[model samples]
Target chain A: MTDIATRATRVVAATGGRRRLNGGGPRAGTIAAFLIPFFLPFVLFYLVPIGYALWQSFLVVRRTGGQYGTSYTTFGGFEQYVQVFQNNEFWSSIGRIGLFGIVQVPVMLFVALIMALLLDTPLLKIKSFFRITAFMPYAVPGVIAAIMWSFLYSPQLSPLIDLLNGIGLHPDFLGPGAVLWSAANVSTWLWTGYNMLIMFSALQAIPQELYEAAKLDGASNWAIAWKIKVPIIAPSIILTTVFSIIGTLQLYAEPAVLRQISSNISSTFTPNMLAYAVASGNNYQQAAAISVVIALITFVLSFGFMRLTSKRAGL
Target chain B: MSNQTLIRESRVSRTVVMALMFVLAIYFLLPIYFLIVAATKPQGDLASTNGLAFSHFQLFKNLGTLFSQSNGIFLQWALNSVIYAVLGAVVGTLLSALCGYALAKFTFRGREFLFSVILGGVLVPTTALALPLFLLFSATGIVNTYLAVFLPSIVSPFGVYLARIFAAAAVPEEILESARLDGAGEFRTFFSVAIKLMAPSLVTIFLFQFVAIWNNFFLPMVMLQKESLFPITLGLYEWNGQTSRVPLLQESVITGSLVSIVPVIIVFILLQRFWRTGLAAGSLK
Candidate 1:
């Protein structure tokens, strides 16, 4: 018994590092047992919802006879899609989120990259202190993050506003023109550290020896960071960019929370927010169409970006 | 540049980098620090005092008010969040590990296709699924219940994706083969051997799922209507929206926000190592 256990332990230790250990374990019945628990919920919650949304999107609510008649949904055949296409509020919400993503995602990712690089360098002291403090906001839910920042952005109670006023540089953080970026600022604060940690972990995985030859060649630290480290971590960057794009498309909680305090953020401030508004107004069919459209746009933009970058970078 | 000048320039640049990092740190932490300060104040002193300074010690009173208001509904929301997040993550992680281990170890037909479909599930924005899920749950008569939020929360494709990678890296097939030779069944071997091996990686998946479920607002927002079933986030949102009428609830909202976030932040800091490993595994690979 002892000898058999020793041999088994040796075998386990020896093959532990291998990636694939396929073709030897379980039969189909057993495999289905393992997968059914997850796949059932995945189908029920995930796949069914998408299919139901598509089905719902195609059916339009119509009255049985005249104005006072009972209402029921029937096949509308792209009528809802046409209405969605013609909606100025929908188009403007899309445009607004597009602009927000165009600006906020890059800005947030850039700061995250810089912070990650800085943390990865030998020049920084007390690294975890700075790292954890910066990352602390991520633990706060987005709604709470918005609530926290809302206090700072409000003119009636903000010390930061007071400080700015003291400097004779009066700024309106919650003004109509600035509230979108104000919401953007809340998102950047909440996510930059999380993204930074992603990039930083990637940076940490680069073997120290990869920088040895460059240093011997007298490459400055900046050159090594931009050339060797950044290039090596390009895949992680692309992955983060794709995740950020998906996140940007789903921007709801932050803007919705901000709308509680600011009159500037309308009901149709974002595509997801617009969907929620329409659904709340008992227009589930139109809302489903908007959701499908948003998901499709998300698919196109993220995949298109991946394809574009992979083609250009030969990644 | 000469070595002497290089040393001097290095000092300057290091100071510059450190300064920049310090500034960024302040920017990230400012709102949270402000929230802490705000939560400690009396309702009367909130607008009267400097927002970043402590006016007085009203935190306990505010928390009392938060938990005592409307028959202690805030406490119910907190308990609901804990139930939803903790239970959801535990089940999600277990299911993910089982499926991921099977995918890694078994060479079955249509396996890759199934995984591809699940991978695509990762990109689907969950907020888009909410309204339809709400409608479907309504159909099934599960709407506005704990199971409504808990059921959907257990289906994390990202958790499965991460688990597959970890299982591929961590669990050894030889051990499973030997366990099978000992006449142990597959489930028995998994529970006895594979789970022990993948314990560390499972913690990472658990933490990831926990945070995702805890941070989830939109799903529960759409699925549940009863205030008693609400998570801390939706509860606080409701409170914040009503702050204009009940001015005293502002302090409680701030206090509740601070209270709701403290435990998660503590857990996050405690399990900091798992997250870096998880992200490194997920992205860099």
Candidate 2:
């Protein structure tokens, strides 16, 4: 044992001496060589761009000439941020998505949880088939999902519109009054199954012994689900909820695609949409400011909710 | 009597559950059903036929017309999507596996810091970074190029995070140590023993990244200006925009949408076995 220990020490010492003289094992140099090539692009593309955005958020640009031709004139410090704060358009987009969150989160998560519970029950047949069907939409590119759903909501081809018009009631799905709900429906259709898969995985992780114990106590299925299952999967439920919230706030593709079919959406449809308008309209500074503000709010909300829930759960 | 009451209640609940499941299955299949019927009809027949009913099933005719109409731009878009998804998934998975192996197995300096940074990055919204990325690419004169989309996708923070977890769980440290003692180089060890252990997770990451890059529209929308370079998502958008001016494009867009999903469905079905095993294994921990 002593000889083995001394040999180990000698090997380590030799490695150290060689590393000091030249470098450590090929592991160190190999890791460095492997990491640098891949990481360089990431640092250059993602990291630098992120840093640039944050930096640009603090500075605003000024234009000298008229609409025909203008050159960047000066920098405005936090003034563009002030403009973002005072813009009603920005606030309305926030409020719009807030309403979206309030309605969409509970309904989507509830459905997902229920589906997960049903699938977790041993009595369910063809679990694999159902799982595949339910999780299939997640593979649908968000753009295509939005496009497909948009077609279904289109006045030109929507089955719902055809049915309504057939019944002598032409309900405009893209109408200002109904468009938000239409958009929300599209989101729910695309995401519910994805969330269900997450919850189902979480549910399957729970040991069968717990259910047997509850059954021995004469627990109803609902009781088993409500008392034992939900609490155990609570972390996953909260995780999906937070993800849904972040997604709803950055909601762009649906509204962007839906806008093509409808006239109801405007420049400031959502905060991201608003940022696009500001940048496209040559209000670069203000756009940067708005982007920063939205990112900050999203960070705070997601982290805050995660902390609150984790603390409550005694994690 | 108590046993009978319990059995009766269980039976009722089971029936209710079955009814709920049936309704949901229909709901899940509803839009897909609509896409099928919509793609079958020509521009004129679209409005005339019952939206859900089969109307002569001109599936082949519409598909042919869709391809023949636009100089086969739909085919180009489909090819672009395949290239992006396949190339991005392969490269991204390999890089992530290497990085994950290093983080999981090596006791290197700054390792924890690097991982924490990546974990934080996983939460940063893509929208927040899109504009800045656009400006950077514009500055570099790579805007409207494939690299603009492909380069940014290769470094997925979430992929790295997941790969690290998988490597830690699957690849045993003793095996790596033994391989090293046997004079196998670090890279060889990673490629041989470590990669084999982490193959399932690598595939999962590949699928996830593939779906992400394939579905990505906002980046391409801002970056690419050349029409021929457009992926299916952008191509469909272009078609959807011009539909009012040229009604034939409407038929084309629906057909394109239908075709666009075929590859995705294929990938999902093919990768499903690994996907299920990966998830089940992940949850075991």
Candidate 3:
């Protein structure tokens, strides 16, 4: 079996690795053993799916002769891509997501940065209490979180609706115009703490000497926080930004869950939703194309943000 | 500034900061508080009573119905979530540790290329992958089976990335050399020596994988159509999606959401140190 071959190969590689102590330049058999377990499934599941989607995206559906004839896939380069580009739903979903990401990512990250900074400051008490409570929603699956928030968004069941109504302000969280923001709020709730934890931990890694040095210069706390701490943790801020961008592009579960309660969320409310819709309608090639497009946009946005900020972040 | 003035200023700022945090905390916890209050209310009290107030002690009754409905499909979903998360994390962590340790300890020719490729895998949207994976799984005749989701859940590129860092730090080259000099093989050295050294990191990876798999909705939703095989997220979604036609299922949906999330929240809180540390380390790269 391949397992035994891998095991034997690894033993030999280890022996060779030890004897040479120079890393032996390479061990073709040895590296494959260790990498195979992860890579086999990684390729089959991760890489293969991506490549398959790309390949599927290129091939348009074809029938041999007529409507009653046997259906098959044939070479149709760029046909699916053309359709994906021409599709109004796809572009609108992208635009809607562009709007969501524009407003939500920054707002969420700002809150997270403020929180992380506050948690880092000596003024806050019961820091872990706040941290854990904020993080609790991250543990709630997106579907359940949406379900929970759907309750809070509902007029019949929401305490917020009641609270706002008593204040002479009527708010519809799931209204056609507001449902997108409501979904964004659910996301911000679920993620803000998780992102905060990332930045806070990065803040935690900052040595005490920098703060002491800044203080010795008679720098105020605000100056020290802004000029010292923020600069030091800019890389992490950039990181969380890139991740939030990627997450924004893949927005699915929240809107999909909210779609159950609100008709405002169309089948193609987000690109992922559009892809899922297309896939569900048995337009596999189109869905594959949409997924590829979404993945490219995610790639470009995440890397673009990282590259844009890396220099300023001092990375 | 005088000492008294400075003290007063600090105190004022402290109060302001605490008040701001307190309000944000309410925003975070309010929905959960609402969920707990609503879950305890019966089907009738759900709308009739105050949303924030517990009108009756119907939590137990609701849970009874939750378990007994459709002969305990909720329980099945709960169990499936556990099986997928627990087993997936264990296998995933082991696989990641092995590959990561090898990459760290061995300087293979193509290691950097391999690592970069895997790093790229981390950015590939998992939800996007679900559709194509469904297509492949269907062709292979394994759609709707546990393996459809389970196989994909265990391959976490992020976990592997974390493992590589941890292995390089935790498992010193000298220890591996010593283990090898003792006539132990690569697998033996990894099992008997490297694994023990990398225990905490592995736990972190396991927790990461566990959470990622547990919170996954789209993958299972795309993969499994069998009601019996559905994870709790998919199950709750299905129930919520049906509440229009079946008004009564709303109560069960609320109750089931509470039940499904309780264990994950508890585990996450308790294992906070392991994952928080891992995350801090993971994000550093």
Candidate 4:
């Protein structure tokens, strides 16, 4: 089991020591042949586009003074970035997502952790049924999930609204104040199971003897779960949290779909949506700046979380 | 007496946990259940009837309308999704396997640097790239074409990352050496020996890419303007947007959404072990 675990780690880590060869292994030509199929498209699609976006972000769009004016991109140092900083809609979208992430990520991860713990325990029967049910939403695309939830959120079509009204409590899921949480619910619904499975798999990796000793000490399942199990699975929890944070920042599809049904959701409901809206309006330079800023924020948040968690774990 | 009390206390806790688990399961399944129930109802019943209960069985009729509407564009969208997902997964998996195998088995200069770059690609949000890709594709006059989505979908750094890990874990050094001694060419040895050992991991990679492409909405939304070129997600979204104008399309949209997700859900449930293996390998990293 330890051997398998070690191999799994090496496989996942992808940082195993380089194999030494007496004659320097395969020829460089052969290696290039193996890699070029991927790297060609990777450069064309991923790398070049990034460079293009960065370059575009620095260029300001100049429109000739007339109807049907010719527009050209000219280098304007930090102009677009300044414009993005000044754009209240961009900041509002960012702030909206910040609020969404601050609340939704922890709530989703907490629920996922509890679900993982429940599945890991002996108290749950029909484990596979429960597991599949939770994980099923991961298979559903964001657009469809949002569509489904939109129907349920509709006061006109929703029995949920009717049921709430029957109890003399009015509920408005698509109201301006409530729409962000409604979008957050779609995300939570989609990802909680996937996160649970991640944490559950980590739980399964723990040695059974770790539990045996605790049980013999008269540790209740609750004590064992919260104390022994939770600490052991902290890395998995952190991993899920980081992924959730990234997903939260890229919130587009759910709100975009919901926007079709609700006038309450603005075109710039999220940063990505804001970027798209800007680009669609022929403001490519500003859109590029927004994209670059969003990417930088994503990089900082994800890496910062990883670094902080590893530091905490090391201590 | 205390031992008996302890047992009774544990039983109570177990009951509480079981009840919690049951409630969660229902919560998880409820939206999907609502989707299924909604899809079966006729257009008028959708607004009038209970959301959880069936009105009239119109799933077949609704599906017919979905396929036959807009010159059967729903079928086209479904086909586009499959083509994009399957072709993308197949080619992407092959490219990833070759690159990953090289990274794992060969001794080469700057290999780790290239691997790190690819890892960086994994962190770069694809959503951020959509607008830039749109501009590039538009410049090349392929903005609304299938290649706009296909070319980008096939480039999966995450797939390469997974393939590299699998190659390192599954392929052994002695076998490659023996194959080399047997006078097999590098490509021949890989195709004959390494691939067989790495087949399971390749499926995992394929499924991951498949789902990613299938679930993709942003790139297509930005790139494709033609309704026929839309994937099911984008197609259903377009239809859903029109439901206010033509309320009858609501049933079609609901039915279409259900139809689009069924195949993916089946694939996921049937091949769950692979997913578990993939997630376990992924999280442990």
Instruction: Please provide, for model 3 over A188-216, each residue's C-alpha lDDT reduced to its tens digit, 9 standing for 90 to 100.
Output: 99999999999999999998987997789
Query: How many Å off is the CA of B160 in candidate 4?
Result: 1.6
Residue by residue across A1-315, what tens digits does model 1's lDDT show? Answer: 998985675466446543423335466578889999999999999999999999999999999779999998899999999999999999999999999999999999999999899898898988999999888888889999999989999888899998899999889998989999999998899899888999999999999999999999999989999998888888888988999999999999999999999999999999999999999999999999999999999999999998998898897
Where does model 2 exceed 4 Å of error? A1-27, A63-70, A164-170, B277-285
Interface RMSD after interface superposition, each candidate: 4.2, 3.4, 2.9, 3.4
Q: Per-residue CA lDDT of candidate 4, range A73-94, in tens?
A: 7999999999999999999999
TM-score of each: 0.95, 0.93, 0.95, 0.95
Worst lDDT 10-window in candidate 2 chain A: A18-27
Each candidate's B-chain TM-score, in sequence, is 0.98, 0.95, 0.98, 0.98
B1-285, model 2: which lDDT tens digit per residue?
Answer: 999997897788778887788788877788888888888887788877777987777889989988876688888888888887789889988887788777776655567788888777767778877888888888889989889888887878777877888888898878877898998988888888889988878889888888889988888887888988888999998888887789778878888888888768777978887665444443332
Model 2: per-residue Cα lDDT at residue B123: 70
Off by over 4 Å in 4: A1-24, A63-71
What's the count of clashing pairs in each model shown? 0, 1, 0, 0
Which pairs of residues collide in candidate 1? none
lDDT of 3 by residue, B81-195 (tens): 9999999999999899989888888865456799999889888889889999999999999899999999999999998899899998998878877777777878888888889
Ranking by DockQ: 3, 4, 1, 2
lDDT of each: 0.91, 0.80, 0.89, 0.90
User: Relative to the unseen true structure, what is the C-alpha lDDT of residue B216 in candidate 2, on a scale of 0 to 100?
Assistant: 85
